[model samples]
Each structure stands twice: as structure tokens, then as C-alpha cells.
Target: MAGAGSWFVEQPPAEPPAEASASFERLYRAFLSARAALGLALVMAQLISVVLGTTPARSTLALSLSYAVAALALWLAPQLRRGASARSLARISSPHWWSAIGVDLILFGVLHALDPSGVNYGALFVMPVLMAAVLSPRMLALATAAMATLGLLGAAAWSLLAGLDVGLKTTQAGLVGSGLFAVSLLAGELSARLAREEKAARGSLALARQQELLNRLVIDEMQEGVLVVDRRGRIRAMNPAARSLLGAASGELSWQLRGRADWQPLVLALERAYGGSAGEGGAEVDVALALDSGAARSLRLRLRFTRQREGSEELCVLFVEDNRELLARTRQEKLAAMGRVSAGIAHEIRNPLAAIAQANALLAEDVAGGRAEQLTRMVASNVQRLKRLVDDVSELAPGMQPDTQPLDVSALVQETCEDWVQVNGVEPGAQSRFRLHIGAPGLTGLFDAEHLRRILVNLLDNAHRHAEPGAGAIQATLDRHGDALDLVVRSAGAPVPHEIERHLFEPFFSTRSRGSGLGLYICRELCERHGARIDYRRATDAAANEFCVRLRTPSSASSA
Candidate 1:
């Protein structure tokens, strides 16, 4: 028995395959059910025979009842209810032969030997033979068949020893044994083939699920929008980017292509794609939508379709991109390239500019207080403007880093405003056009000193250009709020136009032809480097354009 247990034990691979274990559990349960059903059928047949005045021997009745009870017990065993727990009970190598195959063979053999009313029970042996062939190894199945054949022949030999007619009995047992052997071999081969096909199908299904998850992850993280739609205009799937482009709320899931008036253009595009040639690769289309907020949105869409197969539904995939955003991205790339080239050119202009200034100074000395002097003065002024432009451009060079340090916000604002007023030749008294107010004295902030000065000077310059010439026409105020320092420059002028305000900090964008357009842009870059923010708004109290610079104080910076 020990040797038989070792031989029949299933030697699973180092990492047992999940599919193989699952298949074994399924077959095991199926055979248990069949055994229970056969047992009940035998009991019913015995009761019916007794009713017909054909009562069997008392031992035969008891044996049939015992077989039914044992079969029911094994079928409903708690350990066999779950796959993990069923492994030991279901293994063919079990030492005790506790399975239905062993029980069926023993009980059916005894019943055949009883020979009640000479009714043959030999046909019952087929159940155990087929069960072993499908559930156990090929050699084990053959062994089971041999055991049953031996029991049949023994019963026949027993009858022969009793001096009964032995010729017909021995011949019949021999023929049944031959048939059992063939059944065992054929059933075992067929079961093996089915198992192989099932394993392959399960492997394919697992691979397909993994691929689907990967595609979903990639689509969700993409910057461009993606949509999956069927021919009936129902949205099957949509990525985050697509939802954002459509201005759909985050919680909204169900959507139809033709559900809203704004989505009609998309509906038409989808229809065109489906109605056109099946071989068409894809096409790009422009769509304009009127939003509920009285605004219009422009989008570019690329549509493609899955191959229309015979039994599968065709789907359309739309790649959506906001046209305005696309244009802005392209423009930013062009400007970055231009800024690099301009920085190089600005570096080469410094030497020539210095020479021109020296030459102009010399010419002024030779021809003072005349038309020639005026021409020289004009040349000097233009040269200074070009030099300022060059300086601004150099500050914006790609690799430039700020020299950040702590400084008194009030003192810096006061000094920068005084210098700007002197350079621009503004008056110094109460009636002066440019006014400075210091609301906080000891406020310190982290910033580059020279960069801060440049920012202040640019804001003052912009203010002077737009403000009326009167007292408090341009106001520079410094104040502190909690751990922040704010410098607000306000000018009493008409508010900046909405269209131009959006591009104020963009490179090379300006309303004035003579403006270098680098002043505000350079200021914005410097502030960003120092962890500061600059924004423009209309001062409702004064009805003036206000530009506010918010700086991080030392304590706030340290905490961060």
C-alpha cells in the first residue's frame, strides 16, 4: 500500500500550474456526484424488486444500503467543498483509497458475487473503470480495470468449483474483461486531449486581459484626448483628457454623441467616418462648439475605425485636441527657439554699442550747442535704448541663475522708486506724478536685490507710460500680510484690454511698436526664480490698472 501511494501520488511541478489544479478539482467533484446518483438508483431498484415479489437476500439488501450511505458521505464531505481543501481528498495517490472509484469497485464486486436470483451485476463495474480512466493516471486506470476483471473471473471460478455450469460463465467474464481494458485506454487518451485544449484556451484569456489593462493605463495618462464610441453614438469609453476637452464634469460618466447641441459636430464627423469607404485609414476634422458660458471652443479631431469584421461590432476612436491649446504650444516652442538665437545676437552687440557711445561722446565735444550736437544727442538717446534692450535680453538667457538673499522690502522699494523717478525726470514733491508709500518698515523677503530693482523699474516705467501727469498718477505701495510682502504699483489709467492682458508676460508680445516687450517677461521670469508671483488686476477703489508682486518672507521660506 505504501509503494502504491508513492507511485500514484501526483508529482506536481516546482510551481504547480493553476489551470491543472483547477481542472483536477472540477473532475473530482463531477465523479463524486455521479457515484452518489448511482447509489440512489441502486436503492430504488432494490425497493422496486421487493414490491414485485422478487425480494433479494438479506445480505444483498444490507450491502446496497451501506454503499448508498458511504457514497452520500463522500460526496458531501466538508473538506471537498473548497478547491484548496480538496487537494488531499481528490489526489489519486491517496494511501487509503478513500475515493469513489475504490468504493464503487469493492461494493459492486460483492453484489456481483452474491448472485441473488442469478441476476448479473457485472455491468456495474463500468462506472469505476470510466471514473479511474478520466480522473487518475493511465497506469492507475489500467490497474483499476485489472482489479475489477480479476474479481469477475474469481466469481466465475467460485461457481465452477461448486460444480455449476462453468463454460458460459467463464467465457462471459473473459469477454467483459477484454472490453473493460479497451474502455480504460480509450477514455484516458480522450480525457488527456480535452485537458490540453482547456489549458490553451485559459492561457489565451489571461494574456488578453493583461493587454486590455495596459492599453487602459496608457490612454488614461496621455495628454491628448481619446474616445471609444460605437456606431449608434453611445460612448463606450473616455479618457481623462477627453473629458477635460469637452468641459464635462468629473463625476459625469454616461454620454451620447448627439445628446447635446454642442456635440452635434462630433456626431456628424462620426457618421461621415462610418458611411465613407471601409478601407479609409482616417481623417482630420475641425469642430467648433458654443459653450453654455457664452464662449466658443475650437477643436481638432482625428477619427479612425476598427476593422469591420463579420460578427463583431465596429467602433470609432477619436483623438481630440483643443485647437487653441495646440496653437499656443506651437507658438511657445517657436518663441523658445527665437529667444536662444536672440540671446546669442545680443551678446555680440555689447561691444559695438560701447564703441558707438564713445564715438558719440567725442563728437558731442567737437560740436557743442549746434545742429551737429543735436544729431549726436539723438544718436546717444537711441543707443541707450538699444543698450537697455540688450541688457533685458541678456537677463533672460537660458542658463542665468538668480543671486537670492534676504533684504528689507520697504528699503528696497523706496530706493528703487527714487532711482526710477530720477532717471525718468519726474518731480520730487507732493505734486509729482509718481508717488511712493511705505506702509511697512521692517518687512524682509527672499529675493535677488538687482532683480527686484529691475522688476520695480519695469513696473514704474509701465505705469508712467499709462498714467495721467498729476499728483499720485502712479503709486507704488509696500505692505506686509502675515508672512508675505506685497509691492503693488497702480496707475490712474484705463484698464488693460482683455485680449492684450492675457499675453502680457509672453515674449515679444506688446501693444507698443517701440516696446522691446522683454521688460514684463523678464520681470516674470526673475520673480518665478525667486519663488514670487506677479499678477495684474483692476483696482476697483481707484479704477486703475494695478500690478501686484507677492514675495515670500524669510520666515515663510524657511518653514517651506
Candidate 2:
């Protein structure tokens, strides 16, 4: 009975050692083949002498000479092995080349002079085998044919010049030997070609297997899912990670879509935004999927599509990203940083604000009967403003969470703009009148209403304070898209100064004589807390210098 831990014991499989040993085995076989070829030559010499049936003395002399040659070959084997494996196999002239021809000629002369046998032409067979091993197949065949021709010419010259029998047996032997040499040469060439082809095939098979393994290794290691699908949308290939992310086997994805159909909405959103360059679009909404126990968890999916050539067919490779943990961790870090900064500021500024409030109250009572009363009131008002500023700073701490709910963002923008118009008292015929152009209706989203209202008010106030007198009034428009919102507040007046634009959102940074300077900074902070981003930009085509703040609609679950 094994424990559950023992049942799940993990260990690496043994494959690499097996492959290495197989490689060594191939090299050893090649070494043995070269050695066997050399041994064949020695064995052939002994067989030839035995078949000739010469006298004991003559046969012994021939056998001793062959043995001596074999011994010399053995001594050179090490050097031959070293040289043969270097670069190309060492090109060498056959040992019995011209000398073998000379021996054949002498043998013909002896048959003419001594008239031993009418025909004994066994030695000519060795030339073709030796040539095949040493040279290329085509060259070996040509050389062997030439040697056969030369042998025929030598045999004719011997018979005619010596006035010998010139009989049928001698003529037939020359013709038959030449024919055998040519046949043997052709056979050897075919054998060599087949051998080479087999070797190449083996090498190709090994490389293909290795590449497949490498692909599997890479696919298994990736964190994202990668699926290659044909134009018809049938998956053609997938990595192991892709299969796991899709909650299926790689084999299954080849012909079907994996995962839930709920992914389609996000997929369509991504496809629309990214174009064909990215197959899927970034998730604009928090994804909730029913998992075990019907438990719903949030996930952010990014899909991308790319065209690639697979054989002759074009395929779309899909890349899927899971950003749930990444998004959560990012939020956690931001909150932690905000907390530390808030704690430090409270320690440094809260006590000072309290003291200032007490001092102002005392001064107000004492200076009630003089012009000094005016100064005391001013001091008290400034102290109250400072306390408000401190409160705004404290709002930036980590614990400050946005209360998000479904609301009409357009309505919120219009309401805030109207409030700004009323506070600034911009009359219809005033030098700087304020205007609002609300975009088409039904534009809604989920957002922190209070925070959004603040964002609009901040921008409108900035425009009111900076508008040049006698210039065209400010016109603010609240525009909407399918999943995004924007506020363009344009003042038809002087362009914003470059210096002011640079430090517009820095805390405690202000250009006005008596401004708190924390308004824009607070707006930016609130927007970020709600996972919305805002930026200021001058309009390129409009007559008035325009500043814009774009917010991601709640439906757009974009990163903070």
C-alpha cells in the first residue's frame, strides 16, 4: 500500500543517455566497416594462389609475399585510420593499379613462353572491388571498364606477337573476365549508391525527431497558450501550455475550439481594437468564469492573431494571456505605496494644521474692533483651506477605495459642467461664456460617480481660471464611444503656456497667486484609482486651444 505522496512521486525520464549511446554505436559500426574492407584484400590473395594449383615451391613463395604485404598493411592501419577520418577520406592510388596491370602482362607473357594453362584469369576480378571502395561510384565504374579494355588489348598483343596458339580458351577467358569485371563494377556502384541513400535517410529522420522534441520542450515551457489555426478557424496545432490554458488536450484543439464560449465577447473586443496584427483584443471587462463549485473568478484575457505559412496553407496563430494575478499584484503594490506616503504626510502636517486653527480663532476675537479684523479673517480662511488640502492628501492613502456603480457618465459630465458654469457666473453675453455640447444619448458605464464628477469640475475650473478676457468662451463636450468616454474642454483663447503644461499635475504646484495647486493632482489620482487614465492635449484641427481628459468606460476593464 503506497501513500498518496508515493503515488505521485516525480522523476525525470531516461532518454538522453539512450540517445547518446545510440550515437556512439553508429560511429563504432563505421570504424568496423573500414577495417573489414582492408581485410578482404588479404583474403582474396590467398584464395587466388590456392585455386591456381601451382607447384608447392611457387605457391609458398606467393603466399609468403602476400602475408608480408598483409603485415605491412597492419602496421599502417593506425595511420590510415587517422588519415581516412580527416576532412575527406584520404585520396589514394590503388595499391595494385599499374603494378597489377604489369603483373597481368607478365602473366600473359609466361603463358605464351611456358604455356601453363590455356586460361587462368581469376586475378582480374580484384581490380573492380578495390576501385569501388576507394573512388566515387561513377569514377570506379569508369576505371574498372578501362582496366577491362586494357586487359583485352594486352592479351591480344601477347597471342599475336608470340605466335602462340591464339586458341578459343585463351580468347574466351579474356572476354569473360572483362565481362565479369564490368558487371561487378556496375553492381558495386549500385550497392554504394543504395548505402549512401540509406545513410542520408537515417540522418534526415533523426533531425526531424530532434526538432519535434525541441518544439514540444518550448511549448511546454511557455506560460501563455499558443494555438495555430487554419483560415477556417479549425485549430491545426497547439502547444502543451495552450492545451492546458484551453482546458483540453493538444490533439483535441486541432479540429475544435477549446475553452468556454464566454471567451468570444472578449475575443471580439480584442479583434476589433487590435486589427489583424493582434488576433484578439485586450480584455476590456472583468471576466468571470464558472469553475469548480460554480465559483466565479475574474480573469483578464489578451488574444492575438498572426498569419503564418504552414505547408501551402496560411494559418492564424492565436496567443492567449492570463493576467489575473498580474493585475491583482499591481493593484496591491500601488495601494501599499499610497499607504506609506499618506502615513508620512499625516505625521508631518496634521499637527501644524491644528495649531494654525487655534491661533486663528484667538486672533479673530482679539482684533474684532480694528482694521486688524480683516487680516485675522484672511488668516482664518487660509487656515481652513489648508485643512481641506490636508484632507485631500489623506484621501490618497492605500485604504481609499473607489465605490464603483453603474451610472450615466455623460449625465455626470453635463451636471459637473453646469455647476462650473453657475459658480463662475459666465453670462450668455459675457466675454468668456461657457458652453456644453453633450454627445448622442445612451452612453453609460460603471464608475465612481463622485470621483468622475470631481474630474470634470477640476478641468472646467482650470479652463475658467485661464481663459483670456474678450476671447471666445469655453465649450465643453462630453463624448462617448462603445466602451470609453472623453471630456474635451476647449477655451477659444490663448494657447496653454508650455511651462504650465509640464508641471500641471504635480502636487503643491500652481501658477496662480493664491491657488491651492492640488486640484489637478487630486483629479489624476482619483481617475487612476478607478482604473481610468486622463491626459491633456492641444487639439490639432480645432480653432480654440483644447484640453482633453479621456476615461476608460467601466465596460472597458483596462489596466490601471
Candidate 3:
């Protein structure tokens, strides 16, 4: 088993490739500055030799000027590298590099030749070779190293052949050559490794940016609301849905939500999430907001806490979900289940109810006297009423599948409205009271014809009951745009009561005492079955109430 301390030992953090490259570049410049200073010192030594009469004045002056020129080039190297892009910086010019190496090699050879007695300058050639290793390709660096070695030996050979008293020896030249080749090999390998790491670091940076973009898209498209707040209670980020939920304007991007009166609930919930009051399950809070229209609305929201520690600061993430949506979904599921059970029960009850009607008819036939006739008539009316009730209740049983087909929208709607008018005549003293506005008469829609007729009749019946009687009293508008058709029914009437508006389409909910409360609910179910939506709104210009049905085209209906 490993020791406890070994297991706990922390690994050194890896340096980012970009940062490492920058550091290496700085170090390379420092090396150049050091070489330049050494060259300047060498030039000063030659001047001293001339002043001391140890070397000829003419040769020393030339050598000093040549060495001074090389040193000046080395000092200016760092400035040339500044203000370049990464790719440009990574790439070294082959011509510039060759030129520098040639100048140094030639000058060092001449300086060595000029020195017949003391101080061989051949070793200075290693500076140019090492620089080539740092800035050039591996093969070129090795070649430069070989050239530098040959230049050192050639200077020594020239001294031996020319009968000059040179201080340089063959052994010193060989040792310097071997050292340069080793430095070149090591430097080349290190530079190549640095390049690979820099490339990887750049790739990692790009991937991070892509992930951030994807995360932004998902958050923007989410149905639920989300808000991120920092330790100082500043709202850092919010998606579109959250802004809509709070009734905030699009420009309210930087408002402080910490202690504002309108956003107190949000602030409190955030506090609970961060203050340890909320458990692992978070907190579920119900809030009520009074709208600008003086309408009070209640909302169920779930608050989730996500804590992220950043350095010395704590960042808390608050995820807000509207639980009213959850409740609505749950209600729809219950209704579906109830529909199945009610359908089963209605099927069983239907046969017995029919038998009772038949028995009542048989009794009416047997009794046909003065007092018995009156009683028989009363029994017949009650039996008929009971039958109608049973039929209506059975209709509420769910699973009423629609047989959808492509049908001309305007023609079908006009025909259904005509039937309704014939069955229930319009209010008295009304001329052209019922109008038809068909923007696209031949447009086709995906819907069940029978179900469509029922929906129209139900809406028209309500309109006739609530609308005033006269010309232009009721209008049915049919319009088509691309893949959708709209059917709107409007009439003059006071707006529906706010208290009853929300539950208007719910089963067993009705404003009228005599109504069964399933008319509009059944209409909604029928419309939704055919991938359509029905909504009610009071027109802005007048007190005309409107019911608009949006029916999808046959090809795109399934997506609705």
C-alpha cells in the first residue's frame, strides 16, 4: 500500500502552452542580451591588447569593429520580435537566420586569424549555432552545429599551415564542436515539444468557447425560468423566459433584484437557498402578484440552489420553475384517466337507461283515460329529459378520436353557421346580422368535419345568447396564412367575468345554473384532437368578444 502522505501529495499544475511559450521567448531574449555583453567584453579585450602593444594596432582595430557589429545585432534582436501575432512569432525566417549565422561564422574566423598569438575567438561561434538550434528546424540546427565545428577547426588548420604563432590547439576546437552539437540536439527537442503543447492549449480554448455558446442556446430556449445571483445579491444572468415571467421589459437587463419591492419574493427565495434554511430538496414557494390591470395572479414556483465556490467568493445559482404548469399537466392527466373510467361506466349505464324509456312508452300505450292520460304525459316528459341527460354525460367520456382530413375551411365554416342559423333563428329585427369575412375562401385545413361543426355551433350558440341584435351583429372571419388557418367568431357583449374566465373551458364549470358546463370543454377537446387551438379575447375597439380557432395545415398538423 502507498503511504498516506504519498496519496495526499499534490501534483504540480501544468503551465498553459501560450504562457510557456511567452516565458521561453523572454528567456531566449535574455540569452541574446548575455551573449551581446560577452561580445562587447571580447571587443574591449582586443582594444586593451592593442593599447598594451601585445597585438598590431591595425588588426586589433578591425577585430574590435567586427565584434562590436555582431554584439549590436544581438542587442537589437529582442525589439524585432515584439508586436507580432502568435503564428508569426512561432515562425522564424530561414534567410534572416542563415544571414546571422554566416556573419558570425565569418567574423569569428577572421578574428581567430587576426589573433596569431593569444585568445582564440573560435568558441564565440557557438553563440550563433545555439541561436539557430532555438529558432530553426532540427535538421538545420544540426547542420549549423556541424558548420560551426568545421569553422573552428579550419581556423586552427590555417594557423598551422601559414606558419603563424596561434594560441589555438586542435583538441580545444574538437571539444567546443562536441559541446555545440549536444546543445543543438537538446534545444531542438525542447522547442518541438513546446510547439505541440501550445497547439493543444489553443484547441482547448476553442472547445471551451463552443461549449459556452451551446449552453447559452439551451438556457435561452428553456420553458422554465432561471436566474443567477452573486454573493452580493446582484442579478448576473437571466434567460428570456424569466424576464417574461416577472413582467420585466426587455431593457431591464441590469436592475438590482436584491431588495426591490416588486421582486421581494425572488430575493427572499434566493436568501433561503443560500442561508441554509432550504434543505437538499430546495424550497417551494407560492407567490401572488397584482398585475397592472388590478388583476391578482398566483404563481407556484420551486427554488433550487446551486453553490459554486470561486476563489474567495461564493456564487449561488437559483433555478425558478413555475409549478402552476406542473399542476396543469397533472390536471390534464387526471381528466384523461377520468374520461376512461366515465366512458366505461357510461357504456354499462346506457343499456338500462334505454330499457326504462321503452318501459315508459309501453305504459303510455296501456293507459289512455282522462286522469291517466295527464299522468302518462308527465311520465313521458321526465323519461325524455333523463335520456337527454344520460347522452350528454356519456359524451364527456374521453377518447373521442377525430378523423382528420383536408377540407376547404371557409366553405365548411359557412355551411356549419348556416345550419346553426336555420336551427336557431337570429334575434328579431336583424338584417345581415351574421356576416362572413373569408380572406382565403379555398384554403384547405386538417380537421374532422363533424367535430368542427360541433365546435362552431357551440361558439355561435354562446354568441347569439350574449350578443345584441341588429345588422353586423355577429361576424365569422376565415383567413389563411401559409400552413395555418384562423376562424374567429365575434359578437357585441360585455366581457366575461374575470372570476369565471379562467375556468370557462373546464368540465363541470359553468356560469349558468341550467347549463351542464361541458359545452365549451367538449368543444376545446374536439379542437385540440385535430391539432387546433381555440382562444377567447375581447376586441380592443369595442366590447365584441372573439373566439379564434387556429387550425394547422394537413402536412404540418402532426407537429402541433
Candidate 4:
């Protein structure tokens, strides 16, 4: 029996050989094409000599036929190359090139010898020898010149033997031989120089491509939206941030609109920026994109026209700046400063608050009256609220990360839901009020259990507060998988007001006075740390709201 390893072996992928580089293949094709054209010109030259009565009709016919046949063969070389394998194509060495130049030299020699009595068509021979010098290797070019010298001498000697030279045949052959050698030397050097410049240009282009890739990476990873459009307002390119800012979901027509009337507002902005030849927008403009969701987003887009270089497409680069983010960025710095000051004070406040809670407990034990007991309960409740406020601030301290590993998502969701149901006072037998729709129950993926727990608990806590008990049942769903895990928490509730919805995840922005307003913001930060995304959408059910968490590789997933 064959060994197990021998039975199952991995084969590396196949690739073309280096010599079969696209550059060489293209050069070969061009060389063949030029030769074909040279053949036609040769036929034309022969016909013209006959018309002038400088050459006989019989010689003209023979030369014309030879040139016609060679031209047909030259034209067919590219066609043959199309069917060859990479290795075989690269195997075509310098000798093949030399052979081709030899054939061309032979044709020129025949034409020269046939019309020795007529006008010297010797200048026509320069075309093929020069062609070989420009395209073939330096050694091959020298060889081509040597072969051409032999053909010239052979043709002149034939003319002398055929009663055609007078005394100038040898002199003419020597002068032409000198010209061939000089032409080869000069053309070969120039060709070598041109080849070096071309290689340098290719290297420069590779560097330019790398720079472009880096620019694309920076743009794609920006939190601010970026839209690159043409003068026609066609979205030439856009990052995922722009897509989400415009609420353009994947494969959506509105997301990828081209030259449509709906995108006119953006196009008009481009014209305003590039209106004059100066190509500068006087200032940023606030343009609203008409989203299909019926929510119009007013975006502050700063436009600058591309440097209009000739032979290049001109475009407009629109820097999409969100007004809310601009406002938030300025406030975030102030918040960070305040957080530092408050963190120092929170410790001092905690000790006094703990003392007051202890004193209230001791007083409750001493006083048996209804008023005293009620006062103690009130004191304890307020103290707990303050402590919770303190804890929320502590959680916000920077650089915190939860331990992560592969975990069962369905089990995590189920456990958090059960804990939330117990704490929030769901009716004793109303466990079924919370629904679990697990498409992949056995699925396991990377996640921090504590982080997932906090996220789920916060989501469920909000759901219970708004719609879980009474007639409304909260729904928790874990859906179709792979590396990506989708979990959604939804419940029937009054439609979230658009005004509040805009700032829903903004830190310290809360509708409820007693609430800390950090639940969703902290949830988002936690989700981001664990390579997950949290987004709230008005539920498809008109009376419901849904928050969806997508857990995937962080780089590919961006939070709205």
C-alpha cells in the first residue's frame, strides 16, 4: 500500500516563468507587426521602380511575391503566440530573433540583386536591420548587421558576375556595410538606454500604486465620511463611512446612484466649488441627501476640485463632515478634562455616602416607628442610586478590556435574558415572554463573556423597562453565521422619536432625567473593543424598536 502522506500531497499553485513577462510578450507582438508593415512597404517600393521603368516587370513580380509571402508570415506570428503555453513562449530565445532578422535580410538581398541595373533600393534594407537592433538583444543586433553585410556583398558580387556592376559595385557594397555596422551600433545603444528608462518608469509606477493603496487605506478607515465624485456628480468612489452616513445599505440603488436626479444636490455643490477656473469651493456647504428611509441627513460637505492635469480625468473630493460629530469632538475634550477632575472627587464622595447608608441602617434598628422606617428606606434607595452613578463613572475609565475567548453566543444570550427577567420582575410564570430564535444553536465564536453579558444585560434591561412585561414579549435572536455572528434585541414599544434617535448613542445625552445616559455609549465602546458593532433601527414592526449587534473582524465592520 502507498504511504498516507504519498496518497495525499499538496501541489503548489502554477505560475508563468519570468521570461514570459507581459512586457516581453508585448514587445514580441509589436516586432512581428512592424515587420508585416515593412513587407507591404517593400512591395510598394518594387511596384514604384517598375512603374518608373527603372526595373523590369519580371523582377518586380518576383520581388513583390517574396515580400507578400513574408508579410503574410510576419502577420501570423502574433496569432501563433496566442495558443502557446507560458513556458514554451518564454523558451523562444535570441536565436529565434536572429533567424527572423536573417529572413528579412534575405528578402532585401534578393530585391537588391534583382534590380542591380535599376535605382539602388539598398536604403530599404536599413528598415529590417534597424528593427532588429531596436527590439532584439545587443548581440543579436550585431549578428543581424553582420548577416546584412554578407547579403550586401553577395548581392553586389552577383551583380558583377551577371554583367551589372561597372566598377562602383564593390565601393557601394563597402559603404553600405560600413553604414550597417554603424547603424547597428548606434541603434543598439539607443535601444539599451530606452529599455533602462522603461524599467525605471515601471518601478516609479509601482511606487505610485503603493502610495495610492495607502491613501485608500487611510480614507476607508476614517470615522468621517469621504466621497470622491466627478464633475457630473457621479460617485466615483466612496468609503464605508459615506455609505452608512447616507444610510446606503449594500446593493441599494440610493447607495450607488449615478447621474440620477436624486444626487443633484451633491452635483450642484461640486459646480459651486469648481465654478471658476481656480477650482476652489469658497466655503463648505450643508447638503441634504434624500434617504429612501424618509430620513433626510444634512451633511456638511467640503469640496475641492482635483488638480486638472491634461490627459487625466478631473474629479471632486468631497470631505463629508458630520455636523454632530464636529459638535461632539469639541465637547469630548471638555468631558475628558471634567472626567479627570470628577474621578478624584468620586472617591471622597463614596466614603461619605457609605457612612450615611450605614448610619441610616443603624437608626432603622433603633427606631421602630413607621416614619423612621420610611425615612431609612428612602435614604438607602438614594444611596444605591448614587453608588450606581459612581460605578458608571468607574466603568468609563479608559483602557479597560474584558477577557475574551471562544464562547457559545446562544447560551450567553439565554443566561443574560434570564438574569434580566429575574431582576426586572417578569411575572413568575412569564419566562416564555422572552423569545429565543437561534438559527445556529451550536455555533461558537470569539467573544469576551463579561463584555457580551454587559451588552446583553443593558439591552434587555432597556427592553424590559419599555416593553417586556404586561402584553409585550421581548425577542432575542441569534442568526445565520460563519465568522460573523448576528444578535438582535427587539421589543414592541412607542416609535422612538426622531429627535432623540439622532443622539441615542451620544454619551451623556439621555431623555430620562434619572438615567445616566451612558448605557448605549458604553455598550458601543465595549462592542468596538471586542470587534463588534451595535446599531439601533426602527423595527420593521411599526410599534417596535430593535438594536442589532454584528460581531465580526473589526477592520471590516464599522459602527454607525
On lDDT, the leading prediction is: 1
Model 2 TM-score relative to the real fold: 0.42
Measured with C-alpha atoms, the lDDT of residue 222 in candidate 4 is 94
lDDT of 3 by residue, 370-399 (tens): 888788788777767666556656666665
Task: Give the 10-residue window scoring lowest on summed lDDT in candidate 4.
Answer: 2-11
Model 3 pairs in collision: none
Model 1 pairs in collision: none
lDDT of 3: 0.70
| Candidate topping TM-score | 1
- TM-score of candidate 1 against the unseen true structure: 0.80
CA lDDT of every candidate: 0.81, 0.57, 0.70, 0.70
- What are the per-residue Cα lDDT tens digits for candidate 4 across 295-351? 777788877777778898887777887777887787998877766666667767889
Candidate 4 vs. true structure, TM-score: 0.56
Estimate the Cα RMSD of every predicted model relative to the unseen true structure.
4.6, 23.2, 8.6, 11.0
Cand. 1 Cα-lDDT: 0.81
Q: Residue by residue across 1-560, what tens digits does model 2's lDDT show? A: 11111001111222244443354335433533443453354456445756886433343345435534544453345543332221121122533332222333343333323334443443434443343332323443445555555655566567667676557646665776577566655555554454455446666888999999998788768876676655555667777765555455434654644334644543454445445454333223344545434544455554444434465665455565556666767866875686578657866898988998898888788776678888888888888777766766676666667887767877777778767777768675545477777886656765688777776777777777776555356778878755677778776666667988888876668987678677888887887776666677776765457766666765575532
Clashing pairs in 2: 270-281, 278-305, 279-304, 279-305, 280-303, 284-557
